[model samples]
Target chain A: MLKENKKELESDVIQLVPQLTLDCVIFGFHDSSLKVLLLKWKGTEFYSLAGGTVRQSESLDKAAERVLMERTGLDKIFLRQFHTFGNVERYDREKIKKMLAHLIDPDLWYERAISVGYYALVDYMKVFPNPDALSDACEWWDLNEVPALLFDHEEILEKALHALRLELSFQPIGLNLLPEKFTMPDMMRMYEAILNKKIDPRNFQKKILKSGIVIKLNEVKRGVAHKSPFLYKFDPEKYEEVLREGGLFFI
Target chain B: MLKENKKELESDVIQLVPQLTLDCVIFGFHDSSLKVLLLKWKGTEFYSLAGGTVRQSESLDKAAERVLMERTGLDKIFLRQFHTFGNVERYDREKIKKMLAHLIDPDLWYERAISVGYYALVDYMKVFPNPDALSDACEWWDLNEVPALLFDHEEILEKALHALRLELSFQPIGLNLLPEKFTMPDMMRMYEAILNKKIDPRNFQKKILKSGIVIKLNEVKRGVAHKSPFLYKFDPEKYEEVLREGGLFFI
Candidate 1:
């Protein structure tokens, strides 16, 4: 696998854009916690976001989708281009050499590159992680527990989380991160996890209910001590309309 | 001037990242209308937004700011990156050749490129437009009267405007487009121009007042015939705080 990847990299360098790349901060929600998928570099302890270079034949967005699919095996998820990181200091030559090491030729690497950062929201249980050619393992790490990342990935991940939280104010993002049917507390918990702060449960419930994008189901979520909260699911039409018209105010 | 510009371009090409560029949609509100700053290409009837390439030495944002300053002569204005356009069809070889006709070398031109789109808001009266080397003139155009632009610049402008409208819901953008002291009617008019829709004056006033980012002054404008409206100005500290904390909801 290593030899094939090195050969492919040597030849494909001409086909790929030398100074442009895309990185994904894939976030998942499970076990009442917010998590991010990270890749463990081959023969190194450093972890980084799943990312790859753009091919000359593909669009930037297509490249991002390809990266997400290659690492998570999940297609058609809610992937958003949040921000592009192009600080000159982000490209440390020594760091790049250490990260790529034996996988790529030293001469093929460019000294400076710009990364377009994207963030994806996926269901935790559905994703089966797959490492790319240069990585040995792919897995989920709780947001706080994530190890030191390669390059400026730590900054990229922070900005992605910030973008997600800001998006919650005016978009129905819960639909992408939460299950099809969830209790009000469950929804609140997901919001709490993303925001990384405590939200007033009553305030959150009131806002979500007033938005009219979610529908209250007759069935209840069982097995919570003595209380069984009513389960609710998104009204797909209303959710679509709200997303189109842009005024959900879900925070 | 043309020879000097050509020489500069020839020398600067190697300094810029060949496949990446930045474009700006500079929006200004005046005369009860929204205006965009556009450049008329040298010796051609085409217009395009103020834009430039990312230098290897500078970051993406620095490149955008440089482009904005070179054209508008205004520094430290509200510049926000809205989107990055990288569609395969955005690059039309014949179209680009026509646009750059006599300016650039055919061999140096790239077949495919990506553009980072940015939008800026500035006081209409403050900007003194200056054309770049490839452009003959830079001037303001009413949003409705924008001419057929070069490349996919029309799409880029539309996306920037959409992003600006979306940002209005969460940020206090009036501070950038309006004067230090303005009336409620003036504020409402600017909003209407950007949103391209009439908002009920009462509802708009109510929301703005409740946001607590603007302060009412004791003096009223005396120029009006019958009834004079009180003036208001932004509470700068509060506005900055709201921007930092991220929950202004200004519609």
Candidate 2:
């Protein structure tokens, strides 16, 4: 029954007068770095942001989640709808025409397609990157080291980054990026990675500590350095309460 | 050439997939009351939110501007994209199918669709409401007396109102809502309407006056019961700066 309904919906979509697609800018923090999940085309050097079309029966949010899950074996991550890019030039008409001339038939090329862009933050170690049949491989590229991506994906990524920065100013973000248990230095490094700027270590620690969102565990980093930093974990219930109360601090 | 391109795009969409549409919730302030723009259906008791389909060659933002202009005959208003709702059940599929079966043909009933919602704040008096072909009349309804709207519009309006409340809390919002020259009471009333609660008159004045975002006019309101309140207007540039600096106070 589900399959039949899916087929019916697809046929309905084909009969409609406009097309909708979903694009994702998946960001991850690792090794004191901010990286974006990108896919390289199967037979060409062309790379692009991970994306896919929405099934006729699927909600736009479901499409984004499915795209992320397909491209990278991760689920239940922090995903958000950032912006919908609808400029006619967004598809690069000329380039699309050229690509379609060789790839898809010209008859299928003129379809009016609009895409919604969503951004997701995932734990780097938790995701197993899987390249789809259309792509050569999926890999995490340091945001600063991003190669030229196909279409307007670069612009979409930039917009996603701007949204992430804005969110960071008021939200507690590193929890999704760091391991369940980590040292203060580890958390600080993740912040530095996401903010993409050098922050005073002492000031960063003071602000975060004063926020009272992180709880220090009776543990410390093993080995290395003259003094082992204390480990900490986020208190979800308190953090959410702070978020709701509009008392979350951002600098 | 543009017309031909449009036709070709439309045909292509008919052969591809359905595209998401956009609906705008434009709220305005006037007569010491909050108002939202609405369009009444021509032959039925149904009322629809201001809406338009996303053109193949247009962005969502552009589509919103077009819809706003066409519905209200107003341009260059303060507009912002708030959120997009894509619940699978957003449309009453059963109702649509039944309507099409009775009114048109079943073949024409099958179409996949989703809608993105945007909210804008405008000056109510500046707009000339012009109902479209499908609509009987266009008018501003007081927020307190909104009629039952079609589809999931009431929910959409609620979401937009929530976002507006948050904006009022953190941002200086009266520049678009109030006239070029207005009194302090005008600003306070607008705030009270958005906050939906009575604020201490003296405390509100003290806080706003100290913010330095409003400039006192050498004028005052005329024909009042008691002492005429002093007139004041907001400084757009300075208010924007304060917004950026996150200096707006909210409790």
| Top candidate when judged by lDDT against the true structure | 1
* Residues B1-251, model 1: lDDT tens digits: 14445566666654777688899999999999999999998888878888888889998889988998888888899999878887766857776775576776556667688889999999999898999978899999999999988888999999998899888878887887999999999999999999999999998899888878899999897888869999999999988888777665656
* Tens digit per residue, CA lDDT, model 2, A1-251: 12224465456743323356678999998888999998987667778899877665677788889989998788888898987776766756677555534433445543456678899999999889888656778999999999998878988998898777766756677767889988878887887787787778888788888877789899888895768878899988867766655544444
- Report the C-alpha lDDT of model 2 over B191-242, residue by residue, as the tens digit: 8888788888888888887777899988888998889988888877788787
Candidate 1 overall lDDT versus native: 0.86
What DockQ does each listed candidate score?
0.65, 0.41
By DockQ, the best candidate is: 1
Q: Chain B alone: TM-score in each candidate?
A: 0.93, 0.87
Model 2: CAPRI class = acceptable
- TM-score of chain A considered alone, across all candidate predictions: 0.93, 0.88
